[model samples]
Target: MTKQTDSMSKQVETNKNAGSEHPPVKEHYKDSLEGSENNSEGFLAEVKAVKRFWSPVWIVPILCVFIGLWIIYEHYSSLGPQVTLTTSTAEGIEAGKTRIKTRNVDVGIVESVELSDDFSQVILTARLSDGKEDFLRTDSAFWVVRPQIDKSGISGLGTILSGPYIELLPGVSKESNNTFALLDAPPIAAPDAKGLRIFLESDEYGQLAAGDPVLFRGYQVGTVETSAFNHETKKMKYQLFINSPLDNLITENVRFWKDSGVNVDVSAQGIRFEMSSLATLFSGGVSFDVPKGWSAGQKVANNTSFRLFNNRTNILEREFKEFDPYVILVSESIRGLEPGAPVEFRGIRLGTVIEAPMNINDEQIVKNDNLVIPILIHIEPARFTELLGEQFNVVEQYEKGNIKGLRASLKAANLLTGAVFIDLDFYPDDILVQEKQTFANYRVLPTVSGGIAQIQQKVMLTLDKINKLPVENFIQEATGTLETSKETLVALNDTLHSVNQLLSNQSTQELPAVMKTTLHELNTTLEGLQPGSQGYSSSVQTLQRLEQTLRELQPLLQTLNQKSNALIFEAPATVDPVPKAAKP
Candidate 1:
């Protein structure tokens, strides 16, 4: 069998070298085997084909490796690296296929995120961009904060996912390094900042939660974080957070109270106060007050973790310091009243009430409780409100000489209702304008007022007393006076009556005859005395002669009469009755 196999192998090798279609071994076998001759040629052809197929096996392996490398390169160059940017949150970001680009050039891709071993931060595995790895900076800051802006301002978050990023802040120097430092993600919300913590003892907070406002001078500068009762002290505690810069303005002298809504009010000098706003309407805030000419501002020492301050008081202290303010509280006595309530001086509202009570209650000295009321009022300084007025046109009013600075007064709010509001005004009767126009500038004025109701009552009572007086008494007194007058008149009347009676009693016939005889005798005598007849001429001549004779005789008679006058003068009449003034 060995000899035969060797011979056949030698023959097959010789056919392959010759490129013969049929090997010698096959022809030799066909000669010995008669029946298998038809299959021999086919078998030899197959063997030749098998030998040719061996050469390509090494080349096939080489070709397969080349195709594999091409595929890997295509995916790596286009898809970039798989990088994960871990942040505090993933709210606004996409994972997995999320891309990270440097200068808009794709640098990496997000793969997946997982909690780090320490659980302090999230770990992200990202494949770096191919050779484009200079985007990471060492000093760049990263935050997961979202931008919030609404009448306030804007903030920033490092990643688009509302999550923090491992920001690479590059140094100015051109340097290169290979190590990585894991970073911490920013917090979702910051811890309590430095601010005021108000301790309130109230049961008014039912649905009242935090995020409420704390206002100062009409401006909102802070928000509430929580409202709860302190078990230790049995009081309501409110944790308020305010901006850091403004916290320094608070002081210990400030007083805080819940404010009620503002309403139209009156003050001295016909002044009207106007109030409006939602904060004032629903939930009142705390306010501050200070003494006139006193400074409520001071340097604040941040001794503790937070500093508490009152906003309204700070505002009032700053804005109203140029003017005056009257301090007054709202109570049951101040119902239907409000801030800006009139501080009327005379019939004018010179100022207004600055505040009011939302609702308040009171109990008996030792008994009843469960009381509720509507509103109360608070007055600014009388002088301040009166001077400010509604429009606050101080410069114009000053020019008119109607008022000047602060003065305390009890002014009637309304004449009809007779409600009263106390305030100060500028009508300082005689205080020098540039000198003592302000009450704070001088000694406090004494308060005085006969209340309108009291005065009106007194006047009405006087009228009623006059109306109620007895008419009979008045008539009796008048009659007494009439009687005295009648007595005086009676004497004169009696004289007239007596004379009238005497005249009336006289007989008219006798009076007429007597008067007629007297008139006739007087006429006869008068006629006889008239000069001018013949006998009268002769008598005239005779009278002239007698006149001459009498003229001569007069001297002698005068001498004799002188002696007689001497004799008469020597003896005065003794029997003559003394003349007396005649009596009626």
Candidate 2:
């Protein structure tokens, strides 16, 4: 208390000095100090009344904590659906590097790659972008896209530099899926492609497979989507997709056939060559078209079914509806003849051979006396309808012609191939005719030995005649003639020996010298008669003298022809003629 009072007195003394110097200033300063003290007290009061919830020093760390939580939420919210993919191989795939793409746009990334539990397959876990979750639909396809060369063509060429990636083909299915089996190859058609889908059923697989082209005429407009063999039906079933607009070409009457690309047909008519394109030639293809004389029918819808014919000819052969069946009994060997061979009228195909040597058993052959083979053939009257008029009935005509010597004969269709066809023609000369015969419940068409069979029969008959000749008597006569010939030969040998002996004689040896002398003399005579020889010169001189003498006798011969006594009195007529000329 004493120290506080001393300090207060000192301050009062200093204030009194300042007040003595400036009294107004001293009073103002005392008032201002009192107000400041009050303000300071209020400030202290306000500071004491407030409560502290957090420290400013912790602002950074607390903000960091909340920011981290927000970041984590954002990360989880941005993530797309995760999918599992199973494949046979892990080639060209990486856990984090490989991407999933659709239409060349990346939509996801492979999160990890691992083997299946059995280690038989590769499993890929992939996460798609937020909005791309729809790509995981049931019908969607995933395949590893890499550089590949195949019969279809070179594909995924862009993967060569950018590296292989997974391709996602979004499906049209409404259902979604998280797990999928990767395709070994790319699908032939996009899942969402607008087109008509049809099924083809075939007995033989042939060269058809997925990715083979489907052609209309010769233009490719679609692809074979799938080729599967059905075990239950024992037939090959193919799924096909025809692009829009062109898909309209498909109709009920249209027939589908395996287009081997190159069609080479060799028959009795000749060789026919047809080729669609080089692309089809290598990969094979299917072609559809309405057969001749048929309407295109109604347009086919998606999922429609059709029968796949083996070839165009097979389709044509089965197109006709009305036909007549007949059985022909052939005695000739049916070698080179087969089912499906043409039954022709003249040269035109009027029917097809349903079966050759039909239903022949060992017992039947043993009991049969003639050993004739039965052939079943069906003649389509439609083939002759255009030629014989629409009213033409093949069955009635065949029945009528049966009595008029109509016959079925085996004729070689192709000489080189030895393929024979049934030839129906009239044979009025045929003697053995059974007009009302029936074989195996079918009307019989009379048959004759014709074509190569007729030639063979004639040859056999000739051999039979030759075999029946008088061989013993002919041999005896031949022996006598041979003896006479031998005697003649011996006489000729004797004559030759006589000639040899004569040639060995001296006179005969001199005969050559005589012949040589005679030849030399003849040659000399011929030389003397040549243009520069003495005989030629003498003949020329004689001809010249005779020509001059003939010229001299010309006037005398003329005078003798005019006068009877001109030989004795020719000099008088010349003087008389000269005197008449002088008077003129």
Cα TM-score per model = 0.26, 0.66
Model 1 per-residue lDDT tens digits across residues 10-89: 77788779887765555666553453346444322223334464565699889999999999988777653333344444
lDDT of 1: 0.48
For candidate 2, the 10 contiguous residues with the lowest summed lDDT are 40-49
lDDT of each: 0.48, 0.82
lDDT of 2 by residue, 361-473 (tens): 54243224777788899988888776777455545665765346677889988887778899887777874555566666778787888688878888999999999999999
Residue-pair clash count for candidate 2:
0
Candidate 1 minimal-lDDT segment of 10 residues: 437-446
The C-alpha stretches of model 2 lying farther than 4 A from their native spots are: 1-76, 112-123, 157-163, 172-175, 268-271, 319-325, 360-368, 386-390, 397-407, 425-452, 468-584
RMSD per candidate (Å) reads 21.7, 16.5
For model 1, give the RMSD to the true fold.
Answer: 21.7
